[model samples]
Target chain A: MRQSTFNNKFLPYILLLPTMFILVVFLFYPAIETFRLSFFKVHPWTGATRFAGFYNFIKIFSNPEYLHSFVLSAMFAFAVIGLGLFFSLLIAILLNQKIAGIRFYRTFLIWPYALSPAIAGALFNFLFNPANGVLCYFTGYRSWLTDGRTAILVVIIAAVWKNLGYNVIFYLTALRNVPQAALESASIDGAGAIKRFFYITFAFLSPTSFFLFVMNTTYAYFATFGLIDVLTEGGPAGSTRILIYHLYKDFFVHSKTGYAAAESLVLFTLVVGITFLQFQTSEKKVHYQ
Target chain B: MKQVKMAVMMLIITVVLPFAVFANGGVDVDESATASIEFWHAMSGERIDLIQSFVDKFVAENPNIAVDVQYTGSYNDTLNKVKSAYKAGNAPDVFHSYEIGTLGLINSGIISPLDEMADKYKKDIPWNDFFTPVQSYYKYQGSHYSMPFNSSTPLVYYNKTFFEEAGLDPENPPKTYKGIREAALKLRAAGHETPVTWNLHSWYFEEMICLQDEPFVNSDNGRGSELPTKVAFNSAAGQKVLEWWVGMEKEGLFLDVGPGWANHRAAFGSGEAAIIMSSSSDVNRLTAALAEKGWEMGTGYIPRPEGAKGGVAIGGGSLWMTNNHSNEEELAALKLISFISEDESQIAWHKGTGYFPVRKTAMDQLKKEGWFEENPNYLTAFNQLLDSPESLNTAGGLLGIFPEARELIQSAIQEMYAGKPVKKALDEAAAKANASIEEWNDIMQ
Candidate 1:
């Protein structure tokens, strides 16, 4: 490998200044502010402030509704990630075929990735609306969103559907990059198609799958705010009130700034823990090459 | 160099002049000077157009005052926007707020009481002409904090055709909870699956308590004190109401249409549900909707329990002046509010939107126009409000954390409807509401 050295070390520092400035201003500053706010009791409308150590954390942890929301968020994240990965991988494999009109199918498969989450939520809400929805027509006009279990299921389905196209795009690229020579050798050795896929193609796709696992986990944990807001607004006995939705209710709806800030920090910690766990577990399974 | 210096000076003057004018309060009380003001509201769709027409008329009549009307999404969104804007010291001169948000807004120290302005125009504005319940709802600490712009009360809407088919009298719809249950049974016997439906909102629950003359919170519904210490909705009256609702759901006579206002409206309009509890403002839309299906709709006051004696509280938004501008701008904003409160504008607003006319003269004008004769159902809410007893309960609750309290009550109601024990749910909701109230009082105090 050739080593290229810069004549002016200060040139590199000057070049990095804009990016560093942006990161500090936008990301780090707000994060530090949120941490600072978590320890204070602040009035939402009046801008009054009082420092109280661990009071917000105590309040949220002691509240049963907050605890329920935490459990519900975990359930929601798992359901979304599981269903999203399974369906997208299935669709990706199908789209990777050498059939005619393959390009058309691939383009169509990735189309929903371009839709905003709120629009997707609204679309599903209309389709599954209890009174005269297209799906309700087949189910004897049953109201789907009024039932707690069914409402959560509907929300989960909407979340998964909104994210499916994104996962399929990543999986498609991963599937194409799988070494064809290895699969060809396996085929020549009289290995079954499914076996070869599991041994060779699937192994090659593990790294992409691991990356998507983190992405989808974060997406489900945080990015579904618009979807839940539009579709349910965390209702039907708070069955669909995940952590983020609960945090929003406290922050924007109830205007409990300090409590909401505390809740946000808790959620941030949870996401960090989950990401750390995923990386630790993926060390053995994810392929480097 | 001279030309460049001139250009720079011109640019600085152009940019800084407006800021200076704005900083100087953006209004002049001189007879011929224009007092430009911003009016933020939550009106949308046809209501927005109606409000716009009124704004145009106000400007045309008062050439020295220029009013800019802007829609700020729903009531909740409007409150959020106003709070943030007030914190930033740039709130609109006037804005529309829901009655429940009055205490929160007042505590923010950004509200200008309207009593002084009302006193100034007492003769021309017909202050006494405003409905008692509507006017009293906007008053906090014995002074008016907002102008009651659009007021409404819940009413029972039923399908006359279904009532007749079920062998029930359409002219005498259910007047009590037991009566509704009986009617629901008959409707179901006549092949209606879901006979009763209501929008999943705590507003209806609040009305239920008010009908029993029960305070939703302590300290005379937070009117006697600035900060409410606790909620009082978990009393026997509340428990009785929730138990009846749960029983109706268990018996399959009630349908849960979820929290969307449109869903319950669709259930009733599509003839799937024989009866629904909804706001008086839904009169025009419901009539138009059912008219397409050739269904006759009937309206009645919200039903009471077997022996309850109170009536429903008013539910809707009010106009408030923010303390963000100069005296001239405040006076101009007050002028616009007074103009809208007059009989002409109130009559037009009531006719255009199904919201009730806050002024008695507007109601009388509406009656004179044969509006009641054409739409007799619209008279039900007006009569209910007129007949309601003058008590603290009917005045409605005022809490700093009312929005959160409402959500808690709604969730508890949903839990009860889903087969949870009514008392357990109500108690849990009340506890949560009290905690929120304490938190709000802690901060505000």
Candidate 2:
């Protein structure tokens, strides 16, 4: 009986072993290896590796380009996350209404989310192209990507457009889970639409908002890399060169894998620090009940 | 039980019949019985059809051997695919490579050095008969490991429509920087929107390096070494060239454009831009696309600053042998290489594409056939490359990691085009790039 009980308890782990093993091999292993390589200098041509302590990190801070990229990354991250959440919540509230063809609206709203960032970047590039671009023809804006001020602005807009749909889906799902009784009670108390929404709906959606805040911040850091690559290629003097994009340049374009690893470690610490901050600040505000 | 036995017999026959085809390999494998070879090349578009036609003619003539051809994407993509294939132990029998830093792969025991293979096969072609100017691009450590293919150098591409409006002769393009500046002024006077469009940074700077006789990197004679402690691109010649470019920008004589040189070609084709500087290989594509637009096109050698020495540096890529295959497989690959390098095949490549021939004998044969008479546009690029004296620094450049160096140069150039001081931007880029070089050298040591 005891043997059977023990087997039953261990069977779940046995079934999960393959998945756990794969995750470790593909994800955790590379992460650990990258972390270890952060202390090395790599030969660009021969791909030979050697330990160099924190020289790469030191170099990262000292190099003006690297510093610029880090600042750009922070700016890109916050701007994307803030705009993505704001627009998604607004769209979600509008779509939550009992309108005609709600199903059609849902499908249409989520369509852009299905297109990959690389494709989105390409399409946006064509639209933003100074010459022969549709946007330039209509708006009379020349060299949108070549100008530093306009380049970052266009990148942020592209990010928000590409990302708002996914966040809307999350917001709509959270809104659906909101209790009808509470809303009705608030309405009976003569609460205005804005007041009810602010007190009831907003409070209820906090958990979802928090989840998306973390997720969007992460996505802004990593997933937007492909967008930058295809759109601006971190160009117009590296104005749009975010941290992950810089990491890509270091690893592939520069073939400085070790230096890239060091940059990646710095990025990892930044992300972790922000996430910890989010958790600490939000613990009191999150109302599970 | 009796029916089951009959069914089993039918199944066996069904499976065994297909084995007959399998025994012969696939139908596309081209069984000529003399050890069939697979040749993977990155040639695409019209170049694809040209290569296929050549292979077809070769197969028709050399019935004893078969040549299989496949198209991969850009040069970098081709190199990556080859590397992965080598790692996976299933590399192609023959593949195209670049004259870039890929020679390191050969030195690192990833590619079979062609000299040893030549001795073993006793099939060495006369090295002296190859184009002398194109010879340096195909070597590593004093030995040839590749055959130069689709070799090119940047040239000045002008719009005849703009030239006519500016009252300049269509036949004579600029041969000196003074002439180019004068042409730019004339075009602006004639009210052309964009008088010039060029791949601002690379073609502008690298052409100057070749024109002024300076090497971009040092030690393996610019085949990419770690010995250069500094980027000398900030030298007088480099600065002078950069200043000229900046002056053009200031005068609105040229505009910065790209998805690299190809985009510039497209802009020139669309009539949005007048003159463009690009590769000879692109002439076929440009002419094909733009000729029907009724805008006449003119070509010229890259114009130099007054009294500049040396010639334009070589552009385009080469096909290298990798060490991932067995001796027999490499031999099969060499046979395919030999087949492509023949005089007849080279003419087909040249006529079908505007790229220069890599072998001298092929050029001589093509000249005899009056190819230049038929295609007048080929003369400009051909004469420019042939007449230009080859220099170590002028012929080609080597850097520790050429792709990285290209990125640094490109990034800095982008900054300069955006109106940063050329010297300051270049100096900053040089420092960063040198640091990368030092890092590379340390690891290599």
DockQ of each: 0.53, 0.27
Model 2 chain B: weakest 10-residue lDDT segment is B24-33
Quick one: how many clashes does candidate 1 have? 0
Model 1, docking class: medium
lDDT of model 1, residue B18 = 71
The residue-by-residue lDDT of candidate 1 on B1-445, one tens digit each, is 9999999999989998676556444334554557999999998898888998999999999999999899999988988898888887888899998888988887777788787555543323455788889867877777787888998898999999999988999999888999999999999999999889897788988999999999999998888855779899999999988888879988888987777788889988889898999889999999888989999999988889988889778889889988767766877898898888888888888888888889888888888889999889888878989999878899998888889888988899888877789889889888888878887787887
- Clashing residue pairs for model 2: B110-B323, B111-B322, B111-B323, B222-B398
Candidate 1: list runs displaced more than 4 Å. Answer: A1-26, A141-143, B1-32, B116-125
The candidate maximizing TM-score is: 1
lDDT of 2: 0.76
TM-score of 1: 0.92
Candidate 2 per-residue lDDT, tens place, A1-289, comes to: 4554454878899989999999999999989988988887754433456778898888888988889888889889899999899999999988999999998998999888998999889888888865456796688766787677888998999998899889999999999988999999999999998999999999999999999998988889999988888777888778898999989877765657787899999988998889999999997897664
